[model samples]
Target: MPWTLPSRPSRRSLLAGAAGAAGAALLTGCSGGPGTADPDPAVSLERRMRASSVRDSERLLERYDATAAAHPALAERLAPLRAAVAAHTSALSSSGASDGSAAPSAPAAAPAPGAGPAVSGEPVPPKPEEALAALADAERSLAESRTVALAGAPGELARLLASVAACGAVHAYLLTPTPGAAS
Candidate 1:
């Protein structure tokens, strides 16, 4: 005989399921089976931003680990960036608005050539005297992301991402070197 679920569960049971689902959705958006209320677009955008931030941080950490392990000379400068990226990942994870995947595993730090004198990638390498320039670019893009997220994000998710975006702007500033200083 085919098993069939009860056509009508008790009201209390239904309410409990709803609350639990909501909580699960909040903690790990889309983790529950399909048909949950669509998350606000802003929330979706924020989740994307958080994921991007996590990835970027991981890359930075890998770079730092490689350089710190081999060159040691650049550790002072790269250490903070690595720490910041790790913190960014942590913040994104705790935002309670993640896309449900566990944080990306820390990659083995290979001696990938540092993003040299040339600017490569979206955020650009916050390095060589152009660090600030790179950060500005990242912030500008992140701002755009924030605007999108704000439009669709709701409640705590909006609040957290907004706060994180502000911090990202600050990070951009931090990445920039003082005037006339060698990179």
Candidate 2:
């Protein structure tokens, strides 16, 4: 017998073969499918990040209020920045709602007198200058934390955090008095 090559597959056979391969892919694509993971890990993570950010902002607000009350002399300077932090809280709270999680409530007023840094449990200094410096330190710390958190935060949330962090940095700068400059 002549060593003749086998003929190519027919069109019908080719179509059938392709269909079978597609079906196989579909069957295996979702192997161990239902409830394999936490449904949606990304959403869960985002919710957590949002909640953390809210809580941090609230704590910062507390620190601000406490410092203001503890030293009324600085209250006027802190008012605008405090308002900005409150706005950030509201903004963060509203954004979390889109993910189906109820936003955390806004923070309450400052704690009892002589209660220092609410965020870090540190004592608020008695001197107005020291108190402002302490508040600035808290802002810097929180801003640094938020910046670190940017790594895992989702797109919109990351952007929000970054903006808030920048604002915090600004607040810190403003809170710290300039050297040899008039008050």
Candidate 3:
């Protein structure tokens, strides 16, 4: 047989190749286009809830600090509770981040005296007994809020919220004044 060089690909073959490439690009593009769109509603809501929880934790920590500072005797009791709030703030902040890394540590110093109320605009109690009652009330409120938040949170976040609720409940009990204690 006479030797023959292979002919270049035909126009039809080149057109078919280009068409296939275009179809593939279209299919992939349809999956996720370049436009910036909002995330799923559920995911957005969950993120907002996480941010709210972090803010609440920060306020609660500030309240604890103010109460402990005003009444030096209460400092020992409030220290652990404050630490727990800090940890909750840390976890909530980190878990909500896109990168899944821990947030920066909060400053060690507590807010200055008369900074603000723990929740709402109510003033911090002036007396020790009143302060403890206020703290307990705040803890109970936080626990309740956490319980509500858990229902909508994703699996890991739900678990974290539940644990935080349990801790808040315990803190509430510890803050409650004894029957015979001065009021």
User: Which prediction has the highest lDDT against the true structure?
Assistant: 2
Cα lDDT tens digits for candidate 2, 50-153: 88888888888888888877777777888899999998987887745567565545656766655655545666788999888988898889987877776666
TM-score of each: 0.47, 0.70, 0.67
User: Which candidate would rank higher by TM-score, 2 or 3?
Assistant: 2
Rank order (by lDDT, best first): 2, 3, 1
* Model 2 score (lDDT): 0.73
- Candidate 1 structure quality by residue, lDDT tens digits, 134-174: 44455545644653454445556555555555555555555
* Candidate 2 lDDT score at position 94: 71
114 Cα displacement, candidate 3 (Å): 7.1
CA RMSD, predictions in order? 18.5, 21.4, 24.5
Which runs in model 3 stand beyond 4 Å of their true positions?
1-39, 96-100, 113-120, 180-183
lDDT of 3: 0.70
lDDT of each: 0.51, 0.73, 0.70
Give the per-residue lDDT digits (tens) of candidate 3, residues 1-183.
997644544445544543443344334334534563565875777678788888888788778877876777778878888898888888877755568676655835765555545433567788888998898899889887877666556555666677677677767767775454484
TM-score of 2: 0.70
Error of 1 at 26 (Å): 16
Q: Using lDDT as the measure, name the better of candidate 1 and candidate 2.
A: 2
